[model samples]
Target: MANPTNFPDLQVPGGRMHDDQELCEHLLRSLDRPALLEILPSKIDLGGTGLFAKEVIPEGTEVFRSIPLLNCIGHEMSEFMCDYCHTSLTNGIDAAGHLRIAGDALPTISRCTQCGVCSYCSKDCQRKAWRKYHKLECPVLGQHPHASAEARALYRLIAMVKQDSLSEQEWRALAYLKAHEEQWSGHLEDLMYYQPQVDNPHRSTPLAFAVAARSAVRGAETLMQPGIDNLQLYGLYFRILTNDMDVAGPLHPNIGRTVDLVGSLMNHSCDPNTFAFFEGRQLRVRSLKPIQAGEEITVSYVDAREGFMMRHDVLWFKYFIDCKCNRCEEEELRISTLMSQESSSFEDFYQAEKELIDIRNEVSRDYKAFRSEDGINQVKTAISTVVSQIFRTQPWPDTLLPMCHMKQILAELSFKLNTNPNQIAIYTLQSCFGITQRSGPHWVYALHSLATHLTPMTAALNRLKNTPPLLLLLALIMRLLAPPAPPATPPDCPATPRQFWDFYNGLLYELVLQSRKTYGTDSACAVALVEKYARARARSSWLGPEERPLPGERGFAERFGEAQVAMLG
Candidate 1:
């Protein structure tokens, strides 16, 4: 018989934090974020801890915000992206509006001396990064540039804690967070595939590389630190596995990752009251619904749109727990309903969906026709037709909307075929009609689809310089179906990300007027449209208008800077 894996102790060095005082205040104080959230320990098996709402909070209200404890850009994409801000450093334009491609005079990214691959946006960014654990990590990365994401995340945490030399209180708080060392030990061989190079200066097992990185800072002190030593490093590895959050950017939603201290207390739920978004290093949590006092404040650990079985499999594999959330319990599990189900309005939607997928796959295989589209008639028409048919029936706030697949195909298709901007505008209007007709007054699927579609739809309409009845109606529908701003920060800022937030929010107020016009004042659809906005790294098809850039026209990175500068002025 195989022996059981030896797991570390669950209790902290001292369990003094069993009292509620050491929750979030000290951790958030540095970021100037208020200690609005609190943690309560649980006796439940899957529920080690849970965060509770302090007061009756309204929808879209900012609840709590905190900076991540450890963060790093993805190893592969570390170059051509700012390590600090995560802005794309791909292309640049001079003050004279002249284009500069790769290897320009003013190089956008500065390569790290120790690790040749590590790149930063500016000197300020590089300096800020040095103070925040990079000083310890430089040598380890230089030795082997291909360290796994998990190892790097752990290395970042170890470096930060050792440099700051964590207080006992901080260590206690960290220990209170969950780790799956026992469960992880089962996959130990799979985990060790990406160890530090054999002859590397930090010449130890992957776990001890963190300690060796700390060697240069202080000799005996590195060995003496009790909070994150070699044993703790093993346990800390699993802690990171359990609690790390995706570090998304303005352009690319997920470019990196970070570990949250206080946010770890917010447990997983299929139906959650709270949502979180990134603002630089800070993580802002907001209420997605009217959370009552003493109610559990939770965020979705996985995309809720995933089918019950798919969601179950994901949660079970990643989290090692079976979800019994209300949604999970309520859903009637069936294969067809999850994947190829038939709605009332369209029995053949799935067939069309299959065609789109096949075309997308074929296009993907083609090295020439990567389908990142701005305005293509064939691509837009096919997508609109297929999407309209899919939601023809049961469109009222349907979570089963094929959002991910639609977004993927719409962004990447071979537009080598004939494309008419006029046809795209027409197809857009057709889809909008289908959106309203199928979804009716209070259909969230239609709203999200239309709002996302508006980027491309509006792009086509703008090219025509004409607002027909259909185009005008599309505008009204957009006003009725836009994303909103967080209650606290009203999103008027120089950053393109925030500007996009404001642009979306400005359309939200008119929802009542348009809703009333379409569905009458008393109907659910006619009432005000209320939605929580988390400055989500969402890709709105309408946000970026695409056509082949003019010879002097800005590229993606240049255009982002252009848009932000335009907003600033």
Candidate 2:
């Protein structure tokens, strides 16, 4: 059998190299490699069995860091009050020391010493708002009393502008308002009631309020902030409130809020390649395996069990786009009724529900067995079985299985593996593909299964490329199969052993090709890997003209040749 190519050696301090097959062995030897502090110029390479980083990332190398763009103090309350102090308001307020009525009666108001919008009872609170941005916005409060919720939210934002980093537009808007105090003094009766009968019936209340606020700032071009395109800013702001209000519930008081834009961009994939988590105000994105550059970053928004139709509905609602990704395609193929049938009776859906419940029960039993006996292998086998059963009974078998139950299983496995890090490999597969860290281990295991098994199935699916379902499955399989490679190898470490190189390259090649077929070469993952492969081939002294193939040219025969040879030998 041809020896596998050498895996690249990473430059991280205290790091060592091992063969690809010895990944289990190396993992057993060392648990945690080192903490990543910063993103390196070169991406990390994961094709090899062993993990490696290019430079010696210190113990606290910040792998990811981001400050909150928008922060809310008390967002969780059923109703939003003043943006500054967060006090509940009885009714909206007007400039003439009079309160505005919500329905018929006047609503309560909080008064700010520096600015009326601050709405704080105490002088100290007034002082804080003044320092933030209220000094600029105080004079203009009377201009737009019935602004939209989003517009009012924008006003609170202006009042909080303590930083000098205000864009030119924002400063001008502020300055313009200060100059034209007389223009905003009168109680414009037209402003008392909203314009009746608009196109968007649902938007009347909020839109009316927003239009009033915009009217107040209309002439004050100077006050507009730079890069503060009102529409986009307003859109982002609204998106944040819609998604995060529940999570930032009133009980947990926070000064900052985070929105996962990247996570949001990742339209749903039945077999997703990435997972996300929130740390304080920051969103952390991690690859379950080596994620290739340029692939569309994705997250599994729905539970793995949801059949194709159910998953599609939820995804369409949240993302507002039709999902044509790989997993969706597979579900279409495996379950003929998945896309066409709408459940008319609860009993009609009951059979599918029963299958899921049975699978869940069996998984739980397997988890208990693994826990009681400390049998890692047994646990792995049981997990594999449970996963297979779940897949077979899935509402959309073509897509990846639902993640909820799998997440549960993976969590238990993680707990068991806490004492044995070598078991990390088993978990690592799932971690790379199954569930976000928030979902835990069962999802991770399922991810592993998808990445390992389903990804390869794309080749078979390609024959049916014209079919929408097959095309979608191909796209998903590509993402799960091929992820980004880790950063370059360090100079001091030995070159990646042949055995390791062959294993990693073969797996990566297969994944890359399938991904190309499904997601197209333009996909973020495919493009990233193609670039890396080009660079690697360029740098390699061993590749002669005959040995090298053009990008995406290495067929399965060449890529997986060593693996097959080894098995036969």
The candidate maximizing lDDT is 1
On the 0 to 100 scale, the lDDT of residue 321 in model 1 is: 65
Please name the candidate that would achieve the greatest TM-score relative to the true structure: 1
Tens-digit lDDT string for candidate 1 (1-569): 02112223446654433354544456545443332445566423344666666668776456776666666777656877666655454323322323343465754776787777578867988888788668876776676576656667666656666466345555567777777666556544443453453335222133333333233223312422424345455676667767776664311335566777777777787677765555445666656568887777787666554445555655665567678877677653332453344443222533554555555445444525543343344555665676666545443222343334344334323213224333333333333333322322223333433444444433444454332223222333322223231222222332333333333433332343443333333322223232212122123324454233421234534543443343432
User: Model 2: which ten-residue window has the lowest total lDDT?
Assistant: 1-10
| TM-score, model 1 to reference | 0.58
User: Which portions of model 1 show Cα errors greater than 4 Å?
Assistant: 1-11, 14-17, 23-35, 43-47, 75-77, 86-107, 165-167, 189-231, 249-252, 330-369, 372-404, 411-569
